[model samples]
Target: MRRIGLCISLLVTVFVMSACESEDEAQTFADRDQETVKHTTVKPMSNKNKQDFQTLPNDMQLAIVFSSMIRVSEAFDYGIGNPEYFVRSSMTEGEADIAKENLESIQFENKQLKKQNNEAVALLQKTHNQEMSHNEMQQLKENRTAFFEVTESMIKLISQVTPKNAKKTRQQLDQLKKQYTQYSAESVKIMNSIVKKQGADKASFERHLETMLQKQPGQPMLSELY
Candidate 1:
């Protein structure tokens, strides 16, 4: 009887310890998430318009590419910057498959937001050639809100999520941002020069952009969200 009682006490103690450990881990994750807010803080992307994609820091380039891929996927479009294309072309076969799975997993967890994004895409397509009605505009706004809900997760994956190594990760991201800004100034000059010589025809510009993306194969071409 004494042995049985001892065993019961041991089990209770073990269970309590396990529960405490889980709580501690949750707190740690929460702290990490709080720190992640800083990882996301950035100068507006309007700043990117001035810089050529070539001169941006690697991480900044990837960040832009990541955002672009999300837009492409949400819009039900496919191209060099689309999520599947980026994952498949950027990683090895095995890693690419895993990344694809991860994206699906994240999308599953954020299903409602993903659904809203899909609905937004439908509305956007419907209004592509026509003026947006008030309801359409309202839907677009809701879509934007939903899109942002999952943005933190997207950044987490692209920027690296482990908080233990945050200092190193942050330093790298900062350097990339500095370089991205530097290229921004140069890009505006190039764009202005291009516009002056040749009017920005949609067809020609898209052709050029598409050719550029095709040539870059694995590189991300981030959207300006403009």
Candidate 2:
């Protein structure tokens, strides 16, 4: 009887130790799993959608091209002659080269028209007259008209480009379009104010333009410019 009792005590001690070791292992595994959950839960930043000029979505691509042309016109109107600003700010190096190549491919007639517009702006600046010559004024009107037309095109493009699976993209595009339209109207107000003051100083005008551009639909993409 004494021998049996001793054997029973030994067995109970071994069983208790084994049970404790199993509990410890399970707790360690739970802790490791909690760490893994924390690591996997962290989110990454969204990627930028690089514009491919060649393979542009038909409706969307034309909108971008026209928008770029309008920007070039605006730059000319405002005495911002450097294409580098548009090239560097609007696109990556690859896109810039693509755009430059495309622009170069235009026929002589279209190139002449672009040059004529530039000359018209220069003539107006030299004369310092709001009342420009017939040809110069006509070019100015064309530039402004193109800018407005492209703005409409861009709104349409945004509508088409919003992904079917992405409610957020649709919502974002809608809000962007509304803000851009409002700011487009306000740009005229600011331009008028500048004209009233006979055009603000370069620094002042730039600041105003920056503020205005910031309000536009696609300006967030310009963050990559910096």
Candidate 3:
């Protein structure tokens, strides 16, 4: 009986030590997994937020500037483009406030869009580490690469972007602005011609305006107003 009791005590001691070793090994594995996960987080676009515009390529930097300008243009259009009533070409305080609020919101959206684009690029760079929506993600990567590689395509894209995109990711803003200026000049010439030709047919102005819209769709609202 005494021998049986001693054997029971030894068995219990062995079981407890075995259990503790197993627990320690499991904890070690869990710690290793945590360390592996820490390496997979998204890195900042520029040195952990020390990002300077100068760090990017000159063309890329210009593109970003152009995008920002486009957003401002959109805000301007949204705020003052149309109003229910105009009191001598000025808006009511409430209307003005709404416009200002909208402009600010749009600008913030532009910043977020830019950040998303950058994040997408970063994700692509880390393709092996994560899964992505292959179709949209790959297409965006390819399209941006293709566009940036071609001077003409870049110019055309920059020229035609909605005010919002232009506000965030555009370059060659001056060139785009210059193109608008040139279009304005040409439109003036066409309008003068239309005025001369409109002496007989009142609808000729509409036809000419439509013709301009067909040629320059980017400035449709402005053309329509003219």
Model 1: per-residue Cα lDDT over 1-226, one tens digit each: 0000011122122222322222222111111111211121112235556465445433333234323323323222111012222232234455544434433433433444344344433323332221323443344445445434334333344334243544453454344333332232222222223222323343443343334333322232333322
RMSD of each: 23.3, 31.6, 32.4
| Candidate 3: 10-residue stretch with minimal lDDT | 1-10
Which is better, 2 or 3, measured by TM-score? 2
lDDT by residue (tens digit), candidate 3, 1-226: 0000011122222222322222222111111111221121222333444444434432232223222222222222222121111111233455434433333332333334344345435533332211323444344455443322332332334333443443332344333333432322232233223223323232433343334323321221211000
Per the 3 Å backbone cut-off, how many clashing residue pairs does candidate 3 have?
10
- Candidate 3 scores a C-alpha RMSD against the true structure in Å of 32.4
CA deviation > 4 Å runs, candidate 1: 1-158, 199-226
Model 1 clashing residue pairs (backbone):
50-184, 50-188, 51-183, 51-184
- Compared with the true structure, all predictions reach lDDT values of 0.31, 0.30, 0.29
Lowest lDDT 10-mer window, candidate 1? 1-10
Query: Who wins the TM-score comparison?
Result: 2
